[model samples]
Target: MIIPEQTRNNLEFDKLLKWLSSYAHSSLAKRIILKLEPFDSLENIQTRNKLISQCITLINEEGKYSFHGLANIIPILKKARIEGTYLSSAELYTVYRQCLLYSSIKQYIKQNKAIVPDLYALVEEIYEPSDFMRSIKATISEHGEIFDIASDKLLKIRKEIKEIAASVTTHLESFISDKNNAQLIQEPLVLDRDGRYVLLIKAEKRKEINGIIHGSSASGAAYYCELLSTVELNNKLKVIKEKEKDVCREILQKFTNSIRGIANELIINQRRSAKLDSLHCLATFAIEQGGCMAHFNNSSVLELEEVFHPLLKYKSSMIRKSAIVALSLKLEEPARGLIITGPNMGGKTVALKNIGLAVLMAHSGIPVIARRVSIPYLKALFADIGEKQDLMQNLSTFSSHVQNIIPMLNYSEEGALFIIDELGTGTDPSEGAPLAVAILEHLLFRRGLIITTTHHNAVKIYAESKEELINASMDFDISTLKPTFKIIPGIAGTSHAFDIATKLGVAETIVEKARSIRDKKDEAYLSVLEKLSEQMRDLEIKKEVWWKEKNQLEQKLRMSIEENSEQKKLLLEERRKLSERVKEFLRKSKSRWEEVVQEMKAALSEKAYSEGKQSIKEIEQEAETVLKVSIYQDEEPGQFGVND
Candidate 1:
């Protein structure tokens, strides 16, 4: 069956996909699926994906880090900043916005100073974005040039206002329809004084419109009166129209020059941001890859006594018994495969996942707690253990099992860890047991680390007979009627199914009869199983002791390293202090020479200069003495009081 990459489970995997959809301007989900190749739980993927989405949303919405918020947003912002055209650093953008607002408000106060009464009065006139406003904020979010143009619109408008006001002016005049009245005006014939005519002629108004024209007034008198009311109304409209016209012209002129310049800047930033984002993505990818590598690297990567499932620790509060399964015998070479034989619900599946996950976590640069685990560096990991079925292929339980196993058998390279739960269980025992043994042999030949759980006696017997394979199983406590997940080597595991059934209140007659039927032929083999089980218990204790010792040693080593680093820091500080003192001494000698000479003359009277040569020698000796004292006298750490 063809299984898509989406089949695997990661923590919040779906949410991660969604987050990636929003981020990187590309489908991050597909990248995640491709990077984290194998599957363990759909839930793991879903949860992990959700975490990523939450991280992006948290950064995009709140702009604050909760715990490792910066760690999460750094990659995204870095990606956005470098690879994204017109990408802005969120923090830097915020600062840039503040700077812009400061400049704008300052300019507004300076330019509109004549109109606004005060600071607050001007603020009242200026537009502020409302809380409910729902438009895209940053212009040129996609195109660099367009955003730049939109952002600079206000400045362009201001420039336009200056350009148009240079030629326009206001003029005042009166009209007279009577030719006799026209004689009073003299000089030129005052154009149209047609009072009722459409006020079609556009000329500069020289004064405020306050009153009405008289005598020649016709039916249009009331309309003309309305038009000529106040100077305030006329001037404001003219200014507005002129500014608008000039602004349009400026924008058209700039359109040709600014596009390529802005686009280049945007592209550069986009590439840079993408590179930074790639580094962060690589780190996360490493974590996922490393987890898979741990198991596949070592042949006998066992969590002997105190093994815990990395993923399961948070799932249940109930106490769990740890199990051990050894495939070291299978590892004749450095990497060997192990076949684990145990009953149903005997912690077999848990063991398989634990081993796989532990190795994976280790490879990811995380520490794993194990009594003793031998690990090699592995390149890839494939796990097919629990609830893996191919309904799409219309395959049954047995068919699905075979399909899953085929990949491990065919594609797995040497030094890879392959884990299977209840191997060869879906078919008849006769066929499945032999099939399971054959697969184990094939894997062994290839030197792949194979850990399989089984209930078949034939498989267990087969492993025991082979010098290259070892048998291990989980123990059962008869008194408690509980499966004591303790694993024992060189032992065949008993299912204890009947005992468990009896403890669960199965019919007494059926329990007794079943016990009687089984007690006849395999008595000798069961005896060996009991001895091997005892030995497995002892191995568990030894494993725990070894783990404690290893932890203690590691702690001591860490402490020693820290101390050494601190010592080095102290030595460097001492050297710096010494250098500073020497510099201070040299400076003091030049600055305080007069004071030193006066003090020296007072100490060595007239006799000091009795002989010219002797005086010179005495002065030289005094200078040398001062230098020696300055160098030898211990100054306080970081202090440099240079005295001449």
Candidate 2:
């Protein structure tokens, strides 16, 4: 839940957050996403899952409703306080528009219950008992002006002002157009200044006009003055507007009081709407990028099938024929850890980082990018996967990594997943390997899941020695001297370091000299491990074929039984019709039964159908073709010989 800021940056979680928030329509929704944390309880987590699932179903099946006004009105709801609020007419109109929007959303969801029942429950919270919009509409017009029908006293004053305004305009118009005053007036149009109607008259004729002098124009040649007759009525209209404001204030206060009474309910509704917005955004994101909901279990097991590193997948999308591959891993009670070993750039670090980021994603209630994943309730997920050299703190990468692990392991308990990369590389391998083993032993007693990537032979050996720990490796193709990026479980891996260097244009003589400098026993040990890795890869391929055949056989048996039963029923009907031909039909039925038995035997036998399957060599050849592998030349093929 509390993902360290550094960890977030390491996983590029901020970028992921931005991607998710981009789908959100409201600022409140975006804010909620920014502040997302893991739920406290299993029930709470499941509840969130249910809501998200329903929203996904809604958007994926039926199109989403218009979320236009919802975002605009969210600020008003956020601004509304718990204590009380005296909403202004503009603010009240905001609440009114939200009322209409929610009402429409509710109506739309009503017909889509089959698609989204849980979503409907969220929408139901936003429906109010009172028609808030009706009250707002009755008092205020479309232009935010208070209507005359709002109050009788206000209406009477406005009517009287209108009649007085007409009388003032008539007098002003007649005086301006007259031939006697034609030279006196600047223009015939009358202008209203501060609620008083005035005429722009010639400065020389200003004294002649029978009007009270108000003000003179900029040129000082003409005067802008109000007539003596309209002054008293202008005063009346000003007083009436004040009264109208008081009346409007009283109406708004009463409206605010009504809102305050339902303030608690409104807040709850506001929260629900925010929740719905979040669901909508997540659902849309999931649909956009193929993502699956994770399954939960009571058992303390970690399983991931076909899981993609989300950020990596996004990056791979930029290139044509993207080369990013998904990862699959599992750790149950019996196997607490796995040591991933391979040549350089074999994706060992990526695999470790991938697991850590994905667990964090799931922990924070986000749908992970996987075809299928099942995880138990984890206390936490601890990761020490990347380079953490701190120059400011004067810490080397090894010391930084050690500092992280020491404290994490001190407080670590059962039900946590710990991931580390390059476990014994940054320090002396002699001491680091033993230290890593010690750490693993300590974590094992705690019953936590531990996974680490290493090129250390000692680490791989230690892993193989423990039943609780397993060894896995990212496969490197020997012929091409390129990493295959395939994880081969339960097998130790060779570094394949010198081979890669030679392929990358290091002189063959220099590579051979480096290999010879290594202890012969170590060389023999690594060569054995490399052979074992290859054997394990072949075994894995065979195991897959075996499982595939088993599943197919089971399916065939099931279908055969069903079809056989149906055929027996039809034959029984025929037997009932022809008593004379029963024996002949029985003979034919026996022959058909023999054929079915033979077919079943052939389908079940391993050797009988194995011939039709392609050899592992052919599979590898095709894979090499697809990858366009470059095979480096060797001085002596299949022999680990040194060149002079």
Candidate 3:
């Protein structure tokens, strides 16, 4: 879809170019401009015309020293093209003269050591090619003297032209100043190898006023004047041209390196241009919206919400108020297949598209807007969602669906993503459901992610039977009678055929009859022998929960026992520290006692020797009393280590 042309898109593109320029080196940009110098652009009309005129004077004044390279000229040319306004005839002529002068002088300066005109200061450069040619033609026009031009007349005309030529020659110095002199001179002078003058005589010069000199009265005056000037100028031009060539060559050499350096610098400095990022985003959005690159895988699943397609951004605003639906699938036990049943216009098709688009986007490395997006790398994506009916193939929708699906079965990989919309609603559900069920079963065995929307209750039951399959449905608010666009998991709606009809304002009797029929169908499905067995298994889930609870309790008990044991070990360590303190105290007491007892024994023995009385009974009784003091022991378990 083409986005409508708008000011915004144009502005965006301009911004992009500007950003690109930022990364381009100034030198390289110059080279590019030089390459484009010959090309016509806006600048030549307005600014560059003036610049070229001025630059010619400068070049002449400075000789060839100030000359730069064509490499250095490109930027100016580009700027003129992109931003220049307009050029006038006068300005064109000025530029034409300047360019020719520059080109001519460049040659002359090289051959002789002569002073050249200040080319940079000359405003007139090479003007429009057609204008240059026209100017050249104007200088060569011939007019015979009125009723004359015999042999004497030719010699007189030649003499008259030479004097006019000398006068014009002197005016060459004023090429920058004599604007009127430029008008008097015919444009585009032609010169030969010897620089001889060729002139075109005007008839009016023959009628010259007596004793009066008019600018035009001189025959071939402009042509002779330009040639005489050129020959003299050539002397100076020879040296200037040589110097200019050397200067330009040197400048070109330096300019090339600078360009490369600048390019590298810009790339390094502006590598992350916003314009580049924006383009990347746009590309990704396009891929996602266009559903051009989606993939499916086993481990990763994408939960896509209200996703807008990018390709359609310009053509039409995508179904904008579409509700955000949560959708995802993965390869696991219960089932990778989804059975979706809803009324017409319930957005089943849109949902399918959204899923396909989101997958495509994720694989393309683009951002997706979803509450959550977990996508695995998918090997391939196969989808059969749109309408298919072809008389050429003599195939109905059902036949087409089968034809598309049966082949998929052969190539179905374990890591592929598949999207099937309206799986069993194209034909009779009785036959379609069983076929759909068989297909789902086979796909489940392949261990790939599959999402299929079906209208058959039997498919839902089949899904419920397998623990791997999870039932989900698009929510429809019965009051508003609209598909809410919200996908709710694990709840099937029984299609809400009659409920929706009632909300649609159907007659009460008709609604009642429809509900009656729907209920009967629901009852038959619910009461089926296979369904009955599953119901019985579901009712017995409480027993399973009880067993699970018991196992959890035992595990908790074991953890608690381990916690208590750790706590007891901490208490025993505290007791050991107390016992150590008690042992330290006993040791200190014993050391003091030893010192006291030794001193006492020494005094008693000395006194006994002096008094000749041992007093053995008294000494022994005192020792016995000291040793009999009260002693207490710790009440807890004893430790025999150093502290205890």
Candidate 4:
């Protein structure tokens, strides 16, 4: 929550803010975004992040909600708070527009509250001034003009002014139509001068016009004069116009008083609207950059999966999405420091800076550009990246770095993140490497979370020897003589300086001489490291292939299960139909037997006693025949039968 200004600059936090500001619709929202800082409490951060997620859901389901016509109405609202201050038509129109925007936003949230409950909660406090908005709408037109229909008195005054203006125009036309006066006129058009209608007359024949001159033209060749006949009419028109102005002023005053009565509510609404706009901007930026909110853990463990630098992904125009490789980092308990080693331009420093930037973004409630992330709630994040040489202070690079690291050491404690780039580089290898190792040890002892990039063998060995430290490296490809820009943990990296020089067209003799000058043990160590790096790359390829095969197998298994389920359902349906056929056959046989019994009973009567035995035999034969036919009709001859 307490990141130094220098650290923020190192991580390019200001540039990130500028990118966020671009998504905002109103100046007020932009201002809020530009001044954003990390929240001090986890609860606040979680709330803000949830709001952004809810906003994204709302947008996906209902399309983007419009925030157009929203302005910074705080100043206007404050001015309206004065007792007798009357806002101009344009000023009042701005407030009216904001009111309408608020209403629309409120309605949108109400309709989609299920999709974005958190977003709705955020705007629930917005005060909707419906009455005030209606008053302004009825009084003012869209072009910031007071309508004549604003009040009956104002309407009557406007009508009277219209009539007087018509009379003046008629008198002027009659005067111009006279053949005698036509010669005196300079042009056949009427000009309005100082709210008075007049005719352009020839300056030389001004004396013959018998009218009072209003003004002269720029060229002094023409005079604008009002005819004596139309003078009284012009006066009436001017008087009526003044009356209309007074009436319009009174109407505006009435509205201004209404605004002052609800000034506090308006201010509250303005703040809430600005907050909603800010959420919109944050959500839009996160969606554009493929960012997600990170889970905050109470422990000191920090994990990042497929994380990209915010500046690289969002700010760089030339870099393709595929070209920007993501970095994965994990620092857990028992290991408080991470020492990264690699050849130059291998992305070691970038990984270090990215860790710091992720922490800052998480604390500030802006989603990080990562597939997944889980970071601790850091109390402070300190980063010393890039060159710190100060020519004005005449300080050496080594001294400058030490000056910056002193505070980091003083404030280093649990829940703090320390990032140092190219550690131990501005001095002699033997002394600088030892110094960097000591700094790492001190920070680790204080339980501080530290990530540093180094090329020093001492620092790398120290990282390997301690259970509280971890060693990581950026990958380099020997075949192409280029860096892969991938960070691999649990292995110390080799610089590959001589090999790189040989590939870069350095003379063979020079490369060989440099190799020979190197210590034998050191060269052998580097050789082993190179072999280890090669093996790691091989293992990564094998893992990728294995994962692809696993996924294919899983897909096949799912299809098989679905096919089996469908077959079972079909089997059950067939059995059901067979059972229905059996039941129907039994019902028909029972009905036939009952009819035969009735025939036997009728034959047993006294008049038919002699025929009883013959009738019984016939009934038995009929029953046997019915049984055979019903069984055969329902299924195969021997497939089913009552006795079977």
What do the candidate models score in CA lDDT, each in turn? 0.45, 0.70, 0.44, 0.78
Compare the candidates by TM-score and give the number of the best one: 4
Q: Which runs of model 4 end up more than 4 angstroms from their true locations?
A: 219-221, 316-322, 479-481, 564-644
Ordered from best to worst lDDT, the candidate numbers read: 4, 2, 1, 3
Q: Tell me the deviation in Å of residue 644 in model 4.
A: 52
* lDDT per residue (tens digit) for residues 373-482 in model 2: 88886766677777899999999999999887875577556677777778866898899888888888888888888888887777776775677887878887766876
Candidate 1 RMSD to the real structure? 28.1
Candidate 4 shows a clash count of 0
Please write out the lDDT profile of model 3 over residues 1-644, one tens digit for every residue: 11112211311323323332332333343222222211122233223323322333333454323122112222322322332232222332333343343344334333332332232222123222344334423422223111112224334544554564455445444552456434343443432223333332223332321111223324544223223434544444444445544443343333233333333322322222221222223333333333222232335455454454332332244456433444443334435555665556676666666666555445433334343455555555667776777799899999988877765577546656667877765788789989988888787787666777877877876675665566566655566777755554443434656667777788999877765776554654433322222222332343344345444433443344436646544544544454354346445644544444344334333442222122223332333332222222335433111110
* Clash totals, every prediction: 38, 0, 63, 0
Model 2 C-alpha RMSD vs. true structure (Å) is 13.9
Cα error, candidate 4, residue 310 (Å): 2.0
- Write the residue-wise lDDT of candidate 4 on 1-644 in tens digits: 78888999999999989988989988888999999999988999999989989988887788776676778887887888887788888988998988888878888898999888887887787788888888888889889999888989988888888888888888888888989788888898877888899999999999986788988999999999988877888888888888888887787787788888877877777778888888888888777788889899888888999988988876464454455778888889878788888887677777878888888999999989889999888888899998889999999899988988888889845778899988888999989999998898888877888898988877876676677887778887766877776887766797777878888899999999998998765665565556555655654664455445444433443344435646544543544454455446445645654454354344233333233334334533433333232211225532222221
Ten-residue region with minimum lDDT total, candidate 2: 608-617
The reply for model 3, stretches above 4 Å from the true place, is 1-231, 234-333, 375-377, 390-395, 497-519, 523-644
Which model is ahead, 1 or 4, in terms of TM-score? Answer: 4
Looking at candidate 2, what is the lDDT of residue 294?
74
* Range of the 10 consecutive residues with the lowest summed lDDT in candidate 1: 64-73
Worst 10 residues of 4 by lDDT: 625-634
